[model samples]
Target: MKRRTTERKMTDKERKFLVELLACTPSKFKRWMEGAQNALVLWAASMLGMVLGWLILAWLIHLLVNLEVGMRSPYALGVVSLLAPVCGLYAICSSVQWVRNWPDPSEALRQDISGGKVLDETYNVIEAKRFKEPEHGGLIYFLRMDDDRVLVIYDHESIALEMEGENALSSSFEPRRELHIVRAPSTEYILEQEFSGEKLELSAPVDLTVPPDQWPEQESWCEIPWLELERRLGMPGF
Candidate 1:
């Protein structure tokens, strides 16, 4: 019996998509380093807090019990002081290992889109819109691809509101694509979509600088010109 292989060949468009996805790595990596630094700093602070808390606790116990030699407090403090650094070192090592094992931007993007039930063939980006949120200080790219597919890339601190009543928080790099979706916007814009005759509200109203175009057929679509979108995002036109 021959073994069946499940591997599917990538289309040329998919290859291009991968290239575009790879272009996001520098931004993704910078955010990843910043996160790792923040985590290490937080871990150090927590370890210090633990040591100080133990000292305070030990001192309080000593005061309450009225021990004579004061040996117990010193011993306990010594043990904690020794164990804290070990635990901190272990945490650092674990974090480093995890970082080493983390996936690159392209693979991560594939996972995100696949998890969202988007077919691999439609990974191509036909048109793209980019934006930046002043308050959040993050770059947002809206990719309008084939088959009514939309890929929303949230870089760094940018985020989006879910169709459900929940916050769709983004990590260092997130690629969100959904089927039968006409428009995808960041938290900064108010947009709506109708699927199966049911209307879906996406975001709340904001002071949008990009005015909506009058599309006689598809009024729901936020049709921002490609050149203008790039300009507004502070990126040179492709």
Candidate 2:
């Protein structure tokens, strides 16, 4: 085996630039990913169209002319063959869209937790267990916040706020004992008690050593606004 070489580290300027980039909302980042995936899916559907189109055109010609000896319907068959592929392409695209919109049972929790269009802000804590199957699983907390945001707290250091459009705002807090929070979603997500009719509360502070797979592992952590944090906690208004 070859010896591993030391990797070059980012300079201070490069690190600062990366931090600034991370602060930008993930809308564009996710859009680019979606676009790339769509292109691949369309390519696959087109190939499927070619095969299905051939069969459709062949069947139509067979029905119109019965495949009689020395009898061919080239002119009529040409038109049908050309249109068949277009129809197949349209059908595949429609089917793909319908399937994507279909509700998935296994993804229900994740969909709600991630703030999808049909986000289920309300859910009973079915069973919360820390398992290593999902790559040394971390502590995961399920919460239905007052503002209809379903938060999945992975650990004390990081949390994921499910947002609309199958996206999540993954954030890290300053790893301090002091609790913090923002009024709404932001680049950094801090832990705090939001006013709730349900009176939700954590059993205790959860600590995990490893970050979950979905959480964006970042080097920098942002602190919430001091005033907003105080307001949410019901401290004396300034």
Candidate 3:
């Protein structure tokens, strides 16, 4: 049998850095999460688009009835009918695209959610128990650094889970409970840095004990689904 060898640790400064990182998180990530949750709303909107498109098409016909209604042909109706679904898909895609390119966290929330703070304080890694699922895709994080631009850790790989099928993302990326936030007026110069090295720019490396106990464990050893679990926990404004 093989035995474990060494444990990882972080310096005091890194620990403190993470404490500040969790503070400035954008609320847009939370909105993307809730949107994923109420997929029912997305689906409903798609269906509504279809119905609305059909109604508009019908109205176009009625207006045409006044102009050329007496000599109308099937070709015009067919052309309009064909265009309706394209418009419907466009509407759905347009509505959901911002779920990805949320320009600013505050802007996304202002239109979607009410009475939520743009940035909130937090102090517990174990508190991130919401984002623990296979179906959920990856999203953003608000890590803090000494530099001006924040870091963006991309986990674009795929995962095969025990209960579910293939997941395009697989990493244990729970944000350390340290963050600091800038106000809307000061957000003009905010930046993001992508991680290209071996490990994430965590304020401190994760504790081994907490992941197993608080996170959902699958048969696989390499993957850690953090955001999915954290989102579900409805991680409070902390």
Candidate 4:
């Protein structure tokens, strides 16, 4: 594999554009942490509510029927034990469904970009490179958004400027449409795609900040215009 040196550093405008884009998107780890935290909270609350409901039901049954009812009673123990599996099953199913229905990480970013919420330029671009492989090449951007955050962007050339439902309804579908960006820590070398909220681990993590001579493989490294990047990202014309 021929090793091609990086063409050039990002221009000021290009850096600003990247920074704005990064600002609009959350990192992959952060998103996962948030989802886990939410699920834990939900589970805890549900379990607590179930316990209280069980106690209330037991009390009502004893008051209405004049039966001896206590947590240690055989009847209460039997009922609670039976309900345990049902509650566990319900929690497991609920979590699975919630995860399956979770939206792609880029969904919110796309919405923010379309809604003009990407104007907040909080992140600074540390480094950026645009390159393509020899075969089946499309534009790929490796951007260092900060000291720790790195973004690997796959720009689908085929749908660079295509609009939704432009062609016939049946032929309008495109696999992995528009842009897919993977955000990871600078220390991480493996690339992951959060497609439909599922992490699909791809290639090893690439640290692009190193000299091009030390890069893993040689490819056509070049610069992309800010406007062109915007078009590829499905952003409206400025």
Candidate 5:
């Protein structure tokens, strides 16, 4: 006999939140690097093997033919010397790309938690509209409180929020996406939230510490083009 399992459907609010989260896309560098990550690794390995194979073949050619004569000829030596560095450089590049594309530990954990139900503690009730740029294809929740700092949050597959100049917090929202914390940003030191899995991980790095109190008050901040912000921050564009 097989065990029976009952699955409940998500409520309307949950479904809407999920749709928004699913629409957000990762940075361009991530897309490019992850596109052929596995294939790139194999290519790098094959190229290294080819280099070793060529070295062995050169030795055999020297033994079987007038290899000393070829080595003595400046033209033959020049061709060999030129090709060696080119092949070496290509191999080095491919290897670096493979490592750079490796998955982040924090991101991997977030994906895992997405399978479970989102805890009730995630939602923040304030109606303050954070940066809402429909053209950018996403909206971020920006907030300011008692302290001289700002809180920026957004919903992806997981809940990603950061306190400028402080630390970031990311949690899986299997059932819902919300910010439950009410405390304002700290003025003296950075505040952080730690999970059993790993620290906060984001597509782009941000320094909330500098000008930590500069929270966007007017809707004008939303008007600033998304690509422009990405460019200014030295982050990958769409």
Candidate 6:
């Protein structure tokens, strides 16, 4: 009886531990390395891989073969093996480019949670707007909330609001392609309802309880072009 009680207790504790671990914003790999000194070890490895790949590509192209790619043969086979070097170089370049291109972790995290897999598999949230494309394509803007920080809460998904920054963009492109804009109040933005017509109408307001973390460091941000925003949301131009 005592052994059974102990086993049951252990199982309950294990279950609770897993639940808390899943309730985080950063991924498990990231959270584990958040404060660990060993995190730098992985960083160094990635850097080394990039550098080595670059060097290998340089060697293959400049030193290995002095002629153009030829038909399949023993020599060609050897040279073909060198394709790994070219692929490796591309990977390194891509990594650097990705870092240079992204706005911040905010955008990546928002995309991950917006799919709503964090809370439940069946739940997903989408931003909505209206637009029309006539002579050319139109533009529209989507507001990303700079204030909200989403932690993966109990497998619940998140619908991101606001952007990392704000900008003034073109409303339309041509005479035929025109658009209308409906703005919503920043303070009253809700997670529940989907936007309708020209106004922001949110649903699932009940699902949107208090966000887990406090506001993000920045207050509000946007990622949409005003015209594109309308087009994406299926709004027609009048």
Alpha-carbon lDDT of model 2: 0.36
Say which candidate scores most in TM-score.
Answer: 1
- Candidates in descending TM-score order: 1, 4, 2, 5, 6, 3
lDDT (tens digit, per residue) of candidate 6 on 1-238: 0101011111333334333433643554553444242334444565566556655665566566764334333455655456545545555555555444533343434443333222111112123222222212222223322222111111111111112122112222111111112111222111222222233342211111223232122213323343343333343333
Candidate 4 local lDDT, 194-217, one digit each (tens):
222222222322222333443332
The CA lDDT of each predicted structure is 0.44, 0.36, 0.37, 0.43, 0.37, 0.31
Once model 3 is optimally superposed onto the true structure by TM-score, how far is the C-alpha of residue 220 displaced, in angstroms? 45
Better of 2 and 3 by lDDT: 3
Q: Comparing candidate 4 with candidate 5, which one achieves the higher TM-score?
A: 4
Clashing pairs in 2: 114-162
TM-score of decoy 4: 0.34
Candidate 4 overall lDDT versus native: 0.43
For model 1, residues 1-238, the per-residue Cα lDDT tens digits are 1111222444455545544655765565675786578568757886777677766776777689866323354476667667677767766776676666664445555553353322212233344444544344344555564544444444433443333333323333323332232221111111222123222222222222333332111222335544344444343322
Task: RMSD for all candidates, in order, please.
Answer: 15.8, 18.1, 16.7, 17.5, 17.0, 18.4
Off by over 4 Å in 1: 1-18, 26-39, 68-77, 97-238
Least well predicted 10-residue stretch by lDDT in candidate 2: 116-125
- Candidate 2's error at 190, in angstroms? 5.0
TM-score for candidate 6: 0.25
Candidate with top lDDT is 1
Name the candidate, 1 or 6, with the larger lDDT value.
1
Candidate 1 — what's its lDDT? 0.44
The candidate with the higher lDDT, 3 or 6, is 3
